[model samples]
Target: MIDDAPGKGRPTRSRKEAEAARKEQMKRPTGRREQMRRERERRNKLRDKQLAALDGRGDAAYLPARDRGPVRALVRDYIDRRRSVAEYMLPILVVILVLSFIPNPTAVTVVFFLWSVTILSTVVDEIFLVIGLKRELKRRFEPGETKGAVTYGVLRSTQLRRTRRPRPTIERGEPLRDRY
Candidate 1:
C-alpha cells in the first residue's frame, strides 16, 4: 500500500480502509473527573474575581464597565453624599406596617395616605435627581457618557444605603468637590 502511486488506476485506499480512518476520528471522553475538575476551577476563578469587584476590593482593571468611569464615580459620590428619603424607605415601611394594624379606620386611612405621599414624593425626587444629573452630566461630559447612568443612579439611590453593593466609597454627608 505504501508503494502504490497516487490514483493511477489503483485507489490509494480501499473503502474499508477509508471507513476505518473515519471511525478513528471519533473522540472518547478525556474522562469525566478531569473535565469536572477543570470546569470547577474555571468557575472558582471567575467567581473570585466577580466577588472581589462586588466587594469593592478589586482593582480598576477588574471593575465592571458601569462602575469604571470618572462620571460614574462622581454620580456615586453625589448620591452617597446626600441622604435620600428613599434610603429611609425601609424604616418608613416598617412604620407604615405598624400603623396599618391600628384598630381605628382613621389610623389605617392616615397610614395609607402617608404611604401614598411618600411614594409620590420619592418619584418626584428621583425624577428631579435624574434630570439634574443628566443636565450636569451633559454640561460636564460628552453625550453617551451618561447613558444608562441616570437609571443606575436612581436605582442605586433607592437601594437601602447599608445594602448597597460596590459599597459606598464616600461617607454620608461628605462635601462634594467640583472635580468632575
Candidate 2:
C-alpha cells in the first residue's frame, strides 16, 4: 500500500534536492525553445551595451531617428515641398513681375494676395527647418555624464568629433586630395 503521510504523495523533494535538479536541467543540452531563450538574452545584453555606449558623448550618444514608415513619408513630403518651392521660385517671381505691369487695379490686388501666400509658405518652411535642426542637435548631445569608462574611451576615439580643433587638412603631410 502507498504511504498516506501528510508530506508524501511520492517522496517529497527537499529544497536543496529541488535546486540541484533545476541546476542539472539547466546544464543539460537544450532544444529549440531553450536556444531561442538564450538568443533573446544575448540580444538584450548587446542592446544594453549599445545604449550604455551612447549615453555619454556629444555626438556618439544620439541614435539617428528611426525610419518609421509614416515618418519617412512625412520627411519625403517636406523635402519634395521644399524642392518644389525652390524650383518654382524664379518662375513665380517672373510671373509676379509681369502681373505688376497689368494696369487693372483688381489684377494687381490678386497678384499681391498670391505673393503674400507664397511668402507665408516660405516662412513656415523656414520655421520647420529650424525646429528640425534644434531637435536633431538635442538628440545628438548627452543629457549627463555617461557610464562605463571603456565606452567613453571608445566613443571619444571613434565617434566624437572635437569642436575646438580643425580637422586635419593633410594626409601624410601631403594634400588630402593628392593622397587618393
Candidate 3:
C-alpha cells in the first residue's frame, strides 16, 4: 500500500501556515538586504557606463601605441636634451654667486633673489610636469626604456613654466621680474 501524501508521504504545511511563514520571512530584514543589492547593482551599472565612455575614444585615440619606434625615439631625444642642462646649471650658479658679492650688493641681492625664485619655481614646475610626461612616456614607450625620461623631464619643465599661473596684478608694462 502506497501512501499518497502530496509531499511524497512526508508531512506537508497547510496553506495558512505556509502563507504565515512566507509573510514572516518577508517581514524580516530582507528589504535592507535587497536595498543594498540594488545599490551595488546601480553602482556597477554606473561604472560600466563610465568605462564605456572612456573606451569610446577622443584623446585616447590620439595617444600613440606603446610599441611605436618613433615615439620611443622622441622620448630618447627629449631625455638627451634635458640631461645637457645639468652641465650648464653649475656654471650658472657659480656666476650668480660671484655677481651677488659685487660692490652693488642691493642690485646683486635683487638679481640673486629673482634668479633663485625663478630656478626654484622652475624646479617645482618641472617635477609636476615630469610626472605627467613620464606617465605619457610610459603609455607610449615599451617597458624598461629610459630614453624618454630626460626629454620628458626637460620639456615638462619648460611646458610647466609656460603654463604657470599669472600673477593677479602687473603695473603698466612692468615685467614679471619686477613684480617678483
Candidate 4:
C-alpha cells in the first residue's frame, strides 16, 4: 500500500525506475556531433575567461602564472607608476627602420645617431628602475622573496603602455600604498 499524506506532492519512484533514470542521466552523449558541440562550447568559454583575465577584467586566479602572486602585483604597480624611455623604444625603432631604407647617406647617419641615443636612454632608464626597485624590495620583503621581480618589472616596462597585458591598474605618478 502506498502512503499518500495530505501535503505530499507526488508519489515516490520505485527502486528499479529510479536507478534506470539515474543511469540514463549519467550516461555520456553517444553521438559524435553532440560530443563536438559540448567540446566546442567548453573551449569557447575557456578562451573568453582567459582573454578577460589578460585584460584585467576577470579573477586574479585566472591570470597567467607569471602575473600571479603578491610580489608580481607589487612589481607591476611599481613599474606602472613611473615613465620609462623603453616605452618609446618600439615606435622609435620602427621610425629608425623606415629611415634606414632611404638612399641618402645623411638619412643613414641620422638613423644611426637616433638608434644610439634611444638605446642609451633606455639602458639608463632601466638601470635606475632596477636600483630603485631593489631598494624598495629590500624595504618591503625578505631577501629571495622578490626573486625574478626585477626582470619582470623590466620586461613590463618595455612594452607600450597601451599594449601592456593586465592593463596598468595605476596611472603615471600614482603613489604606491604602504601595503600590498
Off by over 4 Å in 2: 1-87, 141-180
Off by over 4 Å in 4: 1-25, 103-105
What is the TM-score of each predicted model, taking all chains together?
A: 0.70, 0.31, 0.32, 0.78
lDDT of 3 by residue, 56-103 (tens): 322233233431344433443343334333334555666777777787
Identify the candidate with maximal lDDT.
Answer: 4
Of 1 and 3, which scores higher on TM-score?
Answer: 1
Task: Tell me how far candidate 1 lies from the true structure as C-alpha RMSD in angstroms.
Answer: 9.5
Model 1, residue 66: distance off in Å is: 4.4
> Can you rank all candidates by lDDT, best first?
4, 1, 3, 2
Q: Please tell me which model should have the higher lDDT, number 1 or number 4.
A: 4
Instruction: Please write out the lDDT profile of model 4 over residues 114-171, one tens digit for every residue.
Output: 9999999999999999999989888999887899999999999999999999888888
Against the true structure, candidate 1 reaches a TM-score of 0.70
lDDT of 4 at 100: 96
Scored by lDDT, model 1 comes in at 0.81
Residue 14 error for model 4, in Å?
13
Looking at model 3, residue 3 earns an lDDT score of: 72
